[model samples]
Target: MKLSSADIARYVASDISDGSYVNLGIGMPMLVSDYIPEEREFILHTENGMLGMGPAAAEGEEDWDIVNAGKQAVSILQGGSYFHHADSFAMIRGGHIDISILGAYEVAANGDIANWLIPGPRPPAVGGAMDLVAGAKQVWVMLSSHVSKNGEPKVVESCALPLTGVGCVNRIYSDLAIIDITADGPLVTAMMEGLKREDLQAKTGAILNFVPKCEILKSFKNEA
Candidate 1:
């Protein structure tokens, strides 16, 4: 299946359990909140010191003080609260967060992550990603199937960039497929509609083992 970045985000949101204490990383990770069911209770924690975060606000409702790891203006749900940055990290480092969804540049077969920095000149800053990767109970990665604009594979034998966390990722939700890192290898748990296992393998750099289909649960319905 040809899935877009938004499809990856929706996939991540669908897996998040109700009442999960989640921390979203920068970039595409921020979009997961948009797909969450409003009636379900989930508390979003920002590493910069806010909790109970609502989705991105409407045009006139943004509060500068309430933002996420991306520093974009956000809103607070009814039971939302704020705290100090140190306390926020404390929660993360203490493993209080149930899941942390992050964007990645590359992920290895062993679940090693390399998302914090680009490999060339003018590299982006490595924010709280390192801590989140190491601390969260489960690390969910949202990214594309390939690396570089040239369509190099992002799922690789080993990451070329500086590492974010070794064996830190639990599940990967990508544009083309959903992968779970197991002792055997990177298992293709699910693929987008119409995409074949061979087609996905051609695009991926890592050795992929296609697990037989089971009763897979639908996570999100396309609204648009």
Candidate 2:
């Protein structure tokens, strides 16, 4: 079976190094906060002007004034602080972020990402994606689906939508596999248990190179 969102989040959280200043994009990327290792320390950054954010607020304990960029209620760690929006972006653009885990609509094998704008007429909200990709020390993508709802591959040879950042992605954690964007190309470092290489390739739009030892992913829970 393919990994669920929680499983993927756990994998991503475990891969995060200790003492890193990280940013979590909205949507599935937000789920990562619930799974970060208890022993590890991470200072979560929110684009809406929050630093050192904690997990989601419990039921009826939410303070609407304190929310993430996605407007979801969240708790602030002991030393967490709120600042001006400009200062929050300054932290991103000034290269202070260690990693930014973002959700992607499409990720090219070359590491280009397109998540902000589709082909629709709705006004686009690029948000902080461009800044995060350009300024973060590493950019990791979280893909909730290997393919779109319409059955199109989300990992493609090239993105069809407008580029978010050119050759900026460093890694990808998907429901099916963990891929690294290397100089050679997108390398499959791990795959879901019981999934065949051919099966994964069929769901992807790009040619994939596998590492010598591709590990199998198992279901995981939030230990926090």
Candidate 3:
């Protein structure tokens, strides 16, 4: 359906439940906050040790001390709280977070995730990804379908990077499509406008099984 990155972001935002505690991972996952309805209350947690994080502050409002997992400066809401790093991780490892939005390099059909590490001289950091993938009740991965800037497939049969976790992802929001990792396989729940199922599959390295008569959201249509 030729969805853009913004479409993927909107898809993830729409799935967030009111008042749910969510942890946004680095990279594309961080963009979900901008799409979330301001009126809807969602508590954001950062592993670097802040909770109840607000959206990116305006110019001159940056707080050097407060930041998200990405280490980017952030703002705190009125009811926000701060804690030690150990305690913050305890909250994550103890399963206090309702949902986690993460960026992925590859997602297996069994829901395995591998976004933290890539081979070579300068590998990507693992950071708090392992904890988030393991602890969150639902792990939503946001990524593009292709692997390279040249447009190779990233939805692989198996991840080439060091895995963050095995069978941790519950849902995936990608540029070209939205999918859910079910017991059966990767189900193509939605495709972007003008994109056909075959077209999406052709670009995907992994096998896909679409649910019969799944409702596909082509555009922003209010919170669902």
Candidate 4:
């Protein structure tokens, strides 16, 4: 079964460290904030200048002053601090962030990520993605295993879209499996239940390596 947005977030949350600082990118990646284990005490950072932020605000509990880089309503933890964009970028660029979770369009076998734009004449939006990818200690992506409309592969041998950052992605959290990009190519670290090695390979644009110690993502299904 395909993992829901919440399921993916929960899985990503599990991999992150308890006291680590993370920058959650917009779109699907932002929802990860909602699933972080309460005891983990991970600090959430937003490019808009909020550190120690909380999940999306409850209905009627929204706060205009508190928001993420996406401009969505957010909440602040007790010790959360709001600062200027300059300082925020410093935190992002100076390598203070431990892990960054982002949504992606395509990821190359060499760990190249293309998430900012597709080839077309449209208004471009390249926010702090480039900085996060380049500056973070580890970069993790959250996306569907295949293109939503055509069922084409998103984890490709090479990215066809505009590059966000090359050789930056460490791991990918997709609906069908958890893949790790290595010097050898895309490694199958974990896959969803009932999906054989061949099944994941057929849908992939590049090769999929099976590490004997690879994990089967059966526990994530238990979250349902």
Model 1, residue 113: C-alpha shift (Å): 0.6
After the best TM-score superposition of candidate 2, give how far the Cα of residue 143 lies from its true spot, in angstroms.
0.9
Pairs in clash, predicted candidate 3: 1-192, 1-195
- For candidate 1, the C-alpha RMSD (Å) to the true structure equals 2.5
The TM-score that candidate 4 achieves is 0.93
Go through the candidates in order and give each one's C-alpha lDDT. Answer: 0.82, 0.91, 0.82, 0.87
TM for candidate 2 is 0.94
Candidate 3 worst ten-residue window by lDDT: 214-223
Candidate order by decreasing TM-score: 2, 4, 3, 1
The stretch of ten residues in a row with the least summed lDDT in candidate 4 is: 215-224
Select the stronger candidate by TM-score from 3 and 4: 4
RMSD of each: 2.5, 1.9, 2.7, 1.7
Model 2 lDDT per residue over 11-126, tens place = 99999999899999988988888888999998999989888998889999999998988898988998888899889989999989999999999999999999898878888888
- lDDT comparing candidate 4 with the true structure: 0.87
Model 1 misplacement above 4 A: 145-147, 214-224
Off by over 4 Å in 4: 219-224
Residue clash pairs of candidate 2:
none
Q: In terms of lDDT, which candidate is strongest? A: 2
